[model samples]
Target: MPVVIPAAELGEFVTALLNTKIPDPDHARTVSDVLLWAARRGVDSHGVARVPRYLELLDSGEANATPELSFSGGPSGVTVLDADRAPGPIALTAAADEAVRRAQAVGIGAVGVRRTVHTGAIGYYTSRIASQGLVGIAFVAGMPNMSYPGVTGAAVATSPLSIAVPTAGSSPVLLDMATAGIALGKIAQYRNAGKTLPEGVAATADGTPTTDPALAKMPLPLGGAKGAGMSLVFELITSVLVGAPIVSSFHSDDPQGRVHRQNALILALDPAAFGDPAAFTEHVSETLAALQGLPSTGEIRYPGQNSAAIASKRAAEGIPVGPKVWGELEVAAEKLGVAVPVTPGG
Candidate 1:
């Protein structure tokens, strides 16, 4: 069974850990926000559950607390960022800002990023760009996971793709999805619990299908051939285009034999390029309203709607954490000796 923790306590504990271990305030803030938002949005796998790995990587020198980010502006509204081997939050934000700037200038901005760490939560970046009154689309890649297109075994990264549009009169539509049948994080959670997974979702190391979490190593594509095709195309948009430092050695060198760290591509567009921003947003709002109005045969959920609703409820109540993760955070807090926040981050 999973554990449950109060939200405020978790946030405070995480803040103390990040501030204690990572000296950079912005990096700490960004990481904290991502973790907190994950919990608030009910994505437990990504919430405080990630802290142990973050600390492990930080201690192991795989992720640096402070990485200097720099950029080169190019023709055709392009920006190339050298992450200087920094953590993802810093690099991703810098890229999003640059994309917004270029889009503002040219009605569109596209950036290719290299040498960054795990950015965590691609929606965070796209939503940031969208909030600035621009339409944004993004793709990010981690080390390779699963096989490619009936290939069964490893071929390319999981290839997560995201698109966010600025709504003039309503909330922007943000669609961020993994080509995998389910999030790899979900598999990890199941494995931790020694549970079985939903059928047809994963394969073993040998690439045969398996529902037993213990035997599962990778998730299959969501819709088989269609899923594989989308992931294949995403690889072209993310890793290859950005020059994935992938070598035969890169795979073996990584613990998972996929992502050594993280790689990403960000594309931003100004709605002004298409037409009036207000009008565009109004149309989106109307369409979404109509869709939501349709009678749900079951528990119908919109892409980002659940997150917004959960945030509202959790804010009034508290963020819930599993007991295992809370215990881990407690130990880290004791080590750092920093006061945890009075309220959890949610």
Candidate 2:
């Protein structure tokens, strides 16, 4: 069973919980908004369901609640953010904002963020950039939770990438994806639902393919070697470039090498810089119209179209949260002395 709660109430609850752990009110609000956005957009695996894990990390000192973030300018249009182990949403929001600013000034802008925690949905950050009428591309690297193709056990991070193109409509054309066949968070969702893992998406502790969520230890790549290779490249360009390399450090023999850190690269390109902004919008609208008009057996939807619809529906009705996630939220609320929102008819 799932409990339905109004979006406003959910956001308030999440913000309160995060405030208990995060000293900075702004950071807490940013994280709360990102989490709620994911939930409303139907990406439950990366949504409020992650609050428990975030709390655990904060309690264990793996994630910083009040980080001293610093920003430095590199070459032209390049900026680097030292998050100092801040939560991913805070760092990512800062980086995305900076990227958009720099892109407005110059033709293009790139921002790199280092020493952050788990970034929820990559699309949220990119969508912010696209909302500014600029092209946005984002990549993130974290500790390994997926296996390399033809390899055993966890050898690489799922390594998500996202691109958002400004469109004529409010919603941008967003493409957010992980290199892995499935996200590790989705695996947790499956376990919470008492459901089996999808075939070829995960492996057992010993490397054999498994459908049992409890027995699954690692996710497989999206396209075997190709996906694994892209993950490697993302790790190199983001983490390695930012000097917070996780892939090599995770495999190092040093026991202290393992750390809870993530790195991200965000790029923004202004359509006005290339040509006329109106022309760009016209082209995008026409292309999308043609694609949508194509004959198909079923409805042909764009990348973010379905998510936008889901968000609208969830906002009007309430966010439907699974029982397991609701229980976790209740536990957190109790521990933090925050009152849980009342669900309708309950």
Candidate 3:
């Protein structure tokens, strides 16, 4: 079904399609950026693959393209944002900026976002905040997804935690990972690609293991009990702390999107908050160099290493999106009265 269009055509096609359902041009652009960046990087799971679902959510009332967000002050270092059922990325843009600023003042900043739809990669925010030469850590907690090891049905959400530090290299040691072995986003990506997942990524509803993508009824916690325990703690700091609450009942994703909430705790610590900034940077660099200098069993990756390389390669060659996704993108573009892409670059 892939209608091969060039990259430019694809972008225009996607832009036009989003514009049709989402009247907010700015939010549409933000969504575009998130999708594009995911593809440009190596995360095919979170990349442009989600366009169809996003469009469907917009066509329905599940995800409101235009939402009026409100912000209120809490603790001096805390800000609570009520998304009023808006897209997650749009609401986060402002909240992230405010958190970094608070970090500038009190050596830490925290923002809680509630009543928003799915937010993309956690690393995106931490990386942005780290460019200010501060150590940035983000905790993204959501609703119940996977179950406790050896249990069935949904029990816990795949709470993701990410961290980033500033460095001169093209890619910093940015680490973004879910507490689970695999994330819900990645499962959806596999479904879209019509491919089976690997064993250990997920399990069937009966607690038995399966690699069938269609049987991915639950997300498995990473490192077993340890990951599950961390997710619970983050759920408290994120959703529970914000007063929105987190449980299996609150977690529902249908064509008619439910009233979901998100909590993001961004902590920024200035190097000066501890000791000399230069010394800290030098120490980190030395450690990284030592790690890289060691003989590698395979590839010595320092977090975010894979993504930076993927982005560089995609920028040069072109992103390798599924042919089916490409076809639908073209069809959507044609429907929107936009030009089709000649290649995937657009």
Candidate 4:
């Protein structure tokens, strides 16, 4: 069974739980905000269900609870951020803000982040940039757990990319995707729901494709070689460029090579730098409208269209939490001495 929780209450609960590990209230709130943003938009795979795993990371010293983040190489529009193993939301949010600031001044901004942990939903950072009326692009590279085509086993990370463009209407045009055919989070979600994995999307420990969620160990690349190549390129531009180099390090014999860490690149482009900013947004809205007006048997939606609708619906009706995730939250809250939010009728 699932429980329904008000978005506000869930956010507060998650924040409190996170604060137990990360004493900084602001950092905790940032992580909770990003997670809740995904949940409200119906991306439950990247939502609050991840809190338990994050707690494990913080507890095991895999992620720094309070990192001393620093920035360098920023005389121009490009900058490098050393996160000191900070949690993903904190590092990426700071990078997004810096990108926006630089873009406002120089028409374009690019920030490379190093030594961060799992970046949940890269779209959050891009959407943050888009909210400032700037076009945003972001990429994340992490430890490899996805399969490469014709490879014997897992060979690439399911690195994600996101782009967001401001529109005249409320929701921005957002595209958030991983290079893998399916995300590990989605596989976990299916396993929790007792559902089978989609055929050809995931593989077993031996790199053989499997439709059973429980048997799936890794996600296959999205378009065979195409996705694996994109993931490799993302790693090169983000991790290698940032001097983190997660892929090569993970495959090396260095004792600490397998340490979990991620890197990211965030870029922001100001439309005013090109032409009339207002006209650009208006044209984007017109383009979306034109696409939606096309004849079809079903609704024609752009990338962020259904997400906006789902956010509105979830905002009013409350977010649904599965039994497994709720139980994990309960255990964490109890351990942290935080009170769990009550469901309407649990």
Q: Which 10-residue window of candidate 4 scores lowest in summed lDDT?
A: 337-346
- The full ranking of all candidates by lDDT, starting with the best, is 4, 2, 1, 3
Measured on C-alpha atoms, candidate 1 has an lDDT of 0.75
lDDT (C-alpha, whole model) for all candidates: 0.75, 0.91, 0.74, 0.93
Which candidate achieves the best lDDT against the true structure? Answer: 4
RMSD of every candidate to native, in Å, equals: 3.3, 1.1, 3.4, 0.9
Candidate 1 is scored at a TM of 0.89
Q: Could you tell me every candidate's TM-score relative to the true structure?
A: 0.89, 0.98, 0.88, 0.98
Q: After superposition, how far is residue 265 of candidate 3 from its true place, in Å?
A: 2.2
Q: Where does model 4 exceed 4 Å of error?
A: none
Candidate 3 runs further than 4 Å off: 1-13, 188-196, 248-258, 344-346
lDDT of 2 at 36: 95
Q: lDDT per residue, candidate 1, 64-100, as tens digits?
A: 7767777875796997888876667778878898999
Residues 199-250 of candidate 2 have per-residue lDDT tens digits of 9998876678899999888888898888899999999999899887888889
Candidate 3 Cα deviation (angstroms), residue 264 = 2.6
Which is the leading candidate under TM-score?
Answer: 4
Residue-level lDDT for 223 in candidate 2: 88
**Candidate 3 lDDT tens digits, 35-56:** 7767777786777778877877
Error of 1 at 258 (Å): 6.5
Task: Count backbone overlaps in model 2.
Answer: 0
How far off is residue 44 in model 4, in Å? 0.6
Clash number by candidate, in order: 13, 0, 13, 0
